[model samples]
Target chain A: MPAPTAEQEQAIRDAVVRGFDDQVRFLQELVATPSRRTDEADAQRLMARAFEDAGLTVDWLYGRGAGDMKGGLVANLFAYKALRAAGLLPEGRVHLQSVPEEECTGNGTLSVMQHGYTADAVVISEPMGEALVRAHLGVIWFDVDITGTAAHAQEMSRGFNALDAAFALIVRLRELEQHWNEITVGDEHFGDQEHPINLNVGVLEAGEWPSSVFDRCHFSVRVVVPPSLGSQRAWEQIEQCVEEAREQDPVVSRGHATVSRSGFFSDRYVLQPGSEAEGLLRELFSDVAGRELEAFATPAYIDSRVYGNYQDVPSLVFGPVAESLHGKDERVNLESVKRCTEIYALYMARWCGVREG
Target chain B: MPAPTAEQEQAIRDAVVRGFDDQVRFLQELVATPSRRTDEADAQRLMARAFEDAGLTVDWLYGRGAGDMKGGLVANLFAYKALRAAGLLPEGRVHLQSVPEEECTGNGTLSVMQHGYTADAVVISEPMGEALVRAHLGVIWFDVDITGTAAHAQEMSRGFNALDAAFALIVRLRELEQHWNEITVGDEHFGDQEHPINLNVGVLEAGEWPSSVFDRCHFSVRVVVPPSLGSQRAWEQIEQCVEEAREQDPVVSRGHATVSRSGFFSDRYVLQPGSEAEGLLRELFSDVAGRELEAFATPAYIDSRVYGNYQDVPSLVFGPVAESLHGKDERVNLESVKRCTEIYALYMARWCGVREG
Candidate 1:
């Protein structure tokens, strides 16, 4: 396939520069309002308000009937053709005509089914960064628990030590990682790919007192699995690994130890390479930014997975450079955000096909 | 030694019965007050008042010099003529014109220098049925800490599970017991002796969060090194055992897996047997109660070791029997308490050379 024409690139830059100010303002507003994964209602409100203000009809999608979607942060927004009619949108002055609509459509999923317009293409406006417009990784989280026995410090020999028990499992768990390193031999779309596997044991609790004989403990875990290893495969491997770990526990002969199975999950994602949407978004971002855009895979996941997975939509991650979104002093570069908004507007106009569907 | 004549036996029995009545009132007063070892001031006051009231010459001794003594409890009580002169005691009771006064001596090394008393012969005067007395086994407390790594739960392979690490150590510690059981051949205290060893791991803690990787864990280990095995040998063995446990941790190769050293120092003691004092007390009780004087051993430790070690004072363990002293609804029967007091008084008088001491 041939690359984009010079004219197409210039138009993208013009549109992005024109739409810079309003786009940056919108991003700032979104980040200012916390949007934790589980804060579905509040997040929806923020997204709906912002999209509607940008001259698009906002449709919210709830995750109802979603079996055990505990860790998912959800709500969908569908903005239609009319957004381009404002002309100000493509030029990035989209915020000039926003009507303040106060009522909440509490039923997000149902509202999406009813109010969503039939468009050739869809955009999921999440906080996902523009950095990973092509390929993004999945997130996985789990909980581990270790239990021992309680005993008085003076008579340590009489009781089994839970802290020791927890440490034993943890050591083996680390060994497992090294073991995986020795065996994992390939790549995913994201990198030189021996599948980007990052594991973080973030939180920990063992004995209650500093000098106490701990009988139980709990720890939280987080991981970003790469697409090289299929999502389902990775999950199964982790669970199996935990079971195999139990076999190493010396205390198992006398009593049982608890290892938790829930809390946080990550799945890898691989967008089909050299797809139709890739060229389309590339032309738009390049034109808007007045520079060659380097497309990369996302480090974390976003709502784009919902569209890419469920509706078979060719969704790419793009938003304000969201580096500091969940942290203290969160900020987005004004130039990048404005460029992203203009690209979004141009994609809607070109990709949506101007026919009455 | 020949058996005593019938009149001598009858006289001894009558004297013990009389002593029992007076002792019941005394024991109730002493036991009713909460005299935990840590509550030294109150315990001292209660002791001093009781000793002086009993008409014994008193002298106070403090480990840190003297007279930080919050309570007026007599440190040492004696009925010797020289010590009691010049109206030293109340009512000249120390003179003992006919019926000699019994003096209760407070052990400075115990219930003073130490946190609590681990005695061979402790007359708590706590309400007990028939002034029950028995020998007690030695006790030791322990505190152990285990450290592990924190990583993403999904990447548990890469993370160190502190809980697991601690758990593993605990298991090793348990295994060490079995090793001890096997290797401790010809250990008369344990060889084929049921419950030759007792261990209790009492407390456990790790990360504060449920899903965190356990960074640090602590558990209390209560192992009773048999009086036969000895604390010196036990401590050496335990130190080596924990050191060996480091081999199981992954981080140990990278750095210290936080294999720490702590002293939950053991206060192992053995009962003093076949002493003149014990024989007299046993005889007195058996005569009064009309039953073979019962002797038994307990898992708990007492202050008898101080006397047996430092002063070479022969010691015996005797206290009121109760369901639980530290648990809920803790109370002793009034009658039992009274019996304990009388027994203590009779024994004290007899052992102190009553009028001669």
Candidate 2:
């Protein structure tokens, strides 16, 4: 497809500027809605309505998914709408897919792939501080349920504290995490990045009463595996770590700690440096952003894995600047949002080739 | 007061035998009732009905207090009923004080003392394997809330794990606990006991999501102070320990761990030996049990502290054999319950001076 002319580029920029205020308002309403896991029906309904308002066929489908995904999703919709408003439409078919559960599991996009939606390239708007993700680590969510003997604190020696066992097990896991991170120092894609793998002790619950030696403790951890290591191999190592703790560590030896997958057993994805899709996106992004596009490996999970890993297609993981992807006071930069919308519009015009509506 | 005649003693045994089945049933019903903290109204009502059936004025009242206190309360009621069944009554006035919150605050018994209830001697039926407690540890409950910077797990190096900080603090507290227990060696009452001071890490809660570095954690602990080291001093030492961890421990230094008293700030109680009350109890217990009364220090908290520590009266913390005072499947021995019922009956009749009804 030929690149969009200078006049068409100016029109795309103008359309994005015209809709910037509406885009910001839409993002504000979305951020205000409570879209916590399993309770995102209202947010999904709002998105469906927005898609219909954009004069697009609302394939009303439907966390951190809310954070990085919301701003990026809005940018996608507005970019598509901006093209139509600029009196243009893509000659080739383009499908705007909105899926959910990208935070805990990537099942939403995986389901979309299963429905056989093929494309020459795929784009995901995940907040990435205005850069493209060359590769991202996959995540494995697992819970460790530990059991120890319970006795009155008066006779504490008779009981083995489950909380203590869990803590010891966590220390062992951290050592494993450190080992994994150490190995990534010389990795091809992740090298030069400090501590590219993280094992997060996300949720912990232990004991019941204040005077009893805790008999049970449960903790969930999120561990990231680089694309070269693979998620399945990472899981095997995690299981072996706990098993060794049980057989060797005195505290864990006194108790039983079992590991089970809880969520997000996903494999890592990589977009190789050279591709026709990447070249076109790079040219379009430099024209709109007034800077060369930069790509780097992120030590976090993303939905682009569904296309790149499963469908073997070139998938671009791009997004606006965001703070706290999965934490309190999460926010996105409005300026980055506007720039990303313009870049997306330009890329779509050049990649698909604009035609008379 | 004259001792019971041989015939009266035989009648007391017969009266105890008659009410034995009902006492066991009452205990079973009480155990079956879910009398968890702040939910003991039903258990208290059941106790009130039992006292009424025994023809004593019901003093309706109120966990670990459950296992030892419930069985003992029923024994007290049945002992009074046995006296009436044996055609005898105490010439002196007897006050039946049934209080609550013994497991947590001991405030229930404290409230009774504040209500102007005074006695020459006190009897508590805490399950202690058919022995009397010479001295028991006081307990202080406190919670530690820890906060650290939060960041995405991909950027985990920028944030500290609050759960890790909590674990380090807990290790420091455990050292303090070990130091306290070590110093208790060669004490007067607790000299023979192994580890009379126990610090238990009970409840723990931390983190929110799996993909973010945990920023917050909260944990509650129960620490016991020997009768010699007052609760206030123990609390001071606990605060100092946490303060030291803040200054010295690297992990704990990265976060703010604030300590606050959650519940149970009570002084240790010692039932000094060779008192007239102890002499009478020893004689009565030997008469019925056909064995010498054994007394030793226990490393658990009890409600007897209210009378012995606050009222300066000889409070006898004694009871039947029990297993698991504050754990699952906690049980009191039925045979020991019968023997304790007989002993309580004889002690009350002799101490208060029985006469013709």
DockQ of each: 0.14, 0.70
Q: Docking category for candidate 2?
A: medium
Residue-wise C-alpha lDDT for candidate 1, range A219-256, written one tens digit per residue: 66555554655556667777776666667556532224
Model 1, B1-357: lDDT tens digits are: 223344433343354444444443443344445453344455446555656565421121112101111110111222121123312222113211110000111334443425533333433332123433343334445666655554323324444556556556666778876775565456533354445455555555455433234456666555656555566677677777777777654443232334333333434444455666677767867755567666544434444445565555565545443322322223444333333434444454444432212
Provide C-alpha RMSD values for all models, in order.
12.6, 4.0
Model 1 accuracy (lDDT, Cα) = 0.44
| Residue pairs whose backbone atoms clash in candidate 2 | B63-B66
Proportion of true contacts reproduced by candidate 1:
0.27
TM, chain A, every candidate: 0.67, 0.93
Model 2 misplaced stretches (Cα beyond 4 Å): A1-5, A55-67, A355-357, B1-4, B55-66, B355-357
Off by over 4 Å in 1: A1-357, B1-111, B114-121, B124-150, B154-159, B163-184, B188-201, B208-215, B218-220, B223-251, B259-263, B284-307, B310-315, B320-357
Candidate 1 interface RMSD to the true structure: 8.9
Q: What is the lDDT of residue A148 in candidate 1?
A: 55
Clash count for each candidate, listed in order shown = 124, 1
> Taking the tens digit of each residue's C-alpha lDDT, what string does model 2 give over B266-286?
887788999999999898888
Kindly provide the TM-score of model 2 when superposed on the true structure, using C-alpha atoms. Answer: 0.94
